[model samples]
Target: MSEEDYRIGLIHATVNSVQPILDAFQVHAPQVTLVNFMDESLIFELNETGTVTKNMARRLLNLVEKAVMSGVDGVLLTCSSFTPVVSEISHLFDVPMLSADVSMLEKAVDMGTRIGVIATVEAAGPTTTALLEKIASKRQKDVTFKTVIIPDAFKALQNGDRTKHDKLIHQKVQELANDCDVILFAQFSMARALETLDMTTTPPILTSPEISVKSIVAKISKKEIVI
Candidate 1:
């Protein structure tokens, strides 16, 4: 299919995560028209509230509804912390929908039993950890999961210091490298740190952007008219 034929709706909880996903699309699906839906405040609110409340969930659904109504070929919920809502209300949309962390989680389980998840946002920790466990269970893979949040990292990115954010995540992933069979970067934005790592020494690092983009493309190609 020509890249021009694919239209994607990228739903994001933070603007910081958008560029990484876009960069992935450029390399993997450049012909696709990428329409982005972002709310930088959503992550702050979720962090403040400690969970996705009923109202917050409604907001997420409304966002996806907007994307569906916009006639996207597929929707990628690039925010790991918000995937549960997308997963829950997926039936509402006739189009294909995906959680950013899911494809990576499936790959992680297939790669090894002990998975280490590194997330920058506290709220994302529980959401991603649960996702990894769920996928592992369904695959009948005996997986042991551990999540470590770079408490200061997401805030740094939100505050406009990308260097600090990436440095903290890269450091933490390296610290956890020897402890687990494989290290998974929990949030979609963390894929940025992959370029800085030495894969020869660290455990295999799994990220969401490229893999998630591939999943969306495959689903849309099969269904032919998710929008």
Candidate 2:
């Protein structure tokens, strides 16, 4: 299929994540069409419960099912907190399905033994760390993780305080620079924080949207739906 013919579905848990991935695609693969499915309630419920409930998983599956039924070539789940659920339900779909952070985490694992994960959501930090460990274990590599959760930053972003949100993440990135081999921002929304940091001065800090977009684009280009 031609690049324009490929349709990738982006499943988001919050409005915060939508734009970053869209920006990434605009920069990296503008020819591919994107279809978005968002459920803001998922994030609210997750924040309240502090975990993924069975109902949440079912909702996520239904969303992906709807995306597939719409004829997307692949599905990208944009929330790190719900990433683990992708592993459980991906086999049910023929198209490739991916959690946004998986590509980033795999790259982090390959780059260093000590990985630092920063997130603005309570659940995202642990979810990212667990996924990192899983990636390392699958590769038979021993890895250590340091996770920092700044719920306040998430609140700040939600309230339209982008300056404060970026500042908080920038501070953590600086703190983790010397301590870790690499730093990873756990949410697609946090990608904006990179603009405020001096990349040359920090450890290889990574974000999900760009890497995930490139991964999905490559897969779709090759017509390979391996997840």
Candidate 3:
């Protein structure tokens, strides 16, 4: 690949919380280009209605494929709960496609036997719990995963109510602090909430950015050739 060919496509639910992750990536791989395709409001809707419309999925796929066609070295999906569709897309592209939460999952598995999944979006809770369970079972260790949702935070973010969103997330995470060994932010957007909450009273809080940044950097250093 040419020096100018390093590019990545980020498919995100919202652009708000993704800035730090991208900034970290920029420092590690300055040559890499980022193509951001954001819905900005879908996560909130999914939280409110408990559904992701087919049309929304279609729109996301279209933009994702566009990024692939635009010559991205790899794709990093930023929405944790949407990995079902991301898995299909990765198969279709037959390239490097990393899930947003793979890093956090790996860390949680290595850290302790009990994991807590905290997602501000209601629809994400059950789905994220299953992911943690699957990862734990693969390691031949029976682990327990507890999921808790912050009521209405997603909706509040959608409505531009940052204070309400932050408060609810802080409260819910604190409530779940006593139950698990490690806290995994199930949604990429929840990173901020994790920071807002008091970490002194809880287990270690893990975010996708730390893991994804490392994962992407490794991929870059290995310099895998796709074509």
Candidate 4:
């Protein structure tokens, strides 16, 4: 297939996730076409319930089904909280389906024994840590984690306070820098905090958007849509 023929679908649970991945694709694989599907209600429900309910899982799966039916070459779910559902139902689709943080977590496992996970949402902390542990176990690597959840930062972002959000995340990153082998921003939206960080003085920091975009692009290029 030609470069322009690659039509990837991005399934998002929040508006904040949209631009970071779009920016990533613009930098890394501009030739690929992107289709976005946003359902902000998923985040609202997750925040209210503090967990991924069955209804939430079903809704996410339905979105993926719609994306596949629309003829996308691959589907990338941008919400880290729904990652487990993606793992469970990815095989149902012929196209490659991925959780945004999987690629980043896989890389984190490879990079360090101590991984730091920073998240703006309460639920994302546990979800990301669990996924990281699972990835490390699969790779037979012993790993420990330090996870910090800043719900206030997410609230700030939702209220359109980008400076406060970035500042909060940046502070956490600095605190975790010396303690962990690598630090991971747990959400696509959190990737924006990278702009305020000086990465040279810190442990390697990994974010989902850029790394996930690269992973999907590679899979599409090789015609390997393996989950």
TM-score of every candidate = 0.94, 0.96, 0.85, 0.95
Residue-wise lDDT of candidate 1 within 1-227, one digit each (tens)?
55478888998888878989999999998989988887767888988988999888888888888898898878999989988887689898888899887888888999998899998888889888888888877877788987899879887877888788889988887788878999988887788878766678788888899999899998888786443
Error of 1 at 83 (Å): 1.1
* TM-score of candidate 4 on Cα atoms, chains taken together: 0.95
Q: What are the RMSD figures for all models against the true structure? A: 1.8, 1.7, 2.7, 1.7
Clash pairs detected, candidate 4: none
* Candidate 4: regions farther than 4 A off: 224-227
Error of 4 at 80 (Å): 0.9
How well does model 4 score by local distance difference test? Answer: 0.90
List the global CA lDDT of all models.
Answer: 0.86, 0.92, 0.74, 0.90
Give the alpha carbon lDDT tens digit for every residue of 1-227 in model 3.
65356677788877655775686576666666787777767666665678667866787788788878887777788887676666666667744778788777878999988888878767677877877778788888888877788757766876778788879877767777888888888877767665567678888888887688668656654656433
Worst 10 residues of 3 by lDDT: 218-227
lDDT sort, best first: 2, 4, 1, 3
Q: What TM-score would you give candidate 1 relative to the actual structure?
A: 0.94
* TM-score of model number 3: 0.85
Q: What is the lDDT of candidate 2?
A: 0.92
Predicted structure with the largest lDDT when compared to the true one: 2
- Which digits, one per residue and each the tens of the lDDT, describe model 2 over residues 44-148? 999999999999999999999999999999999999999999889999998888888889999999999999999999999989998898889999999999999
By how many angstroms RMSD does model 4 differ from the true structure? 1.7
Candidate 4 local lDDT, residue 84: 90
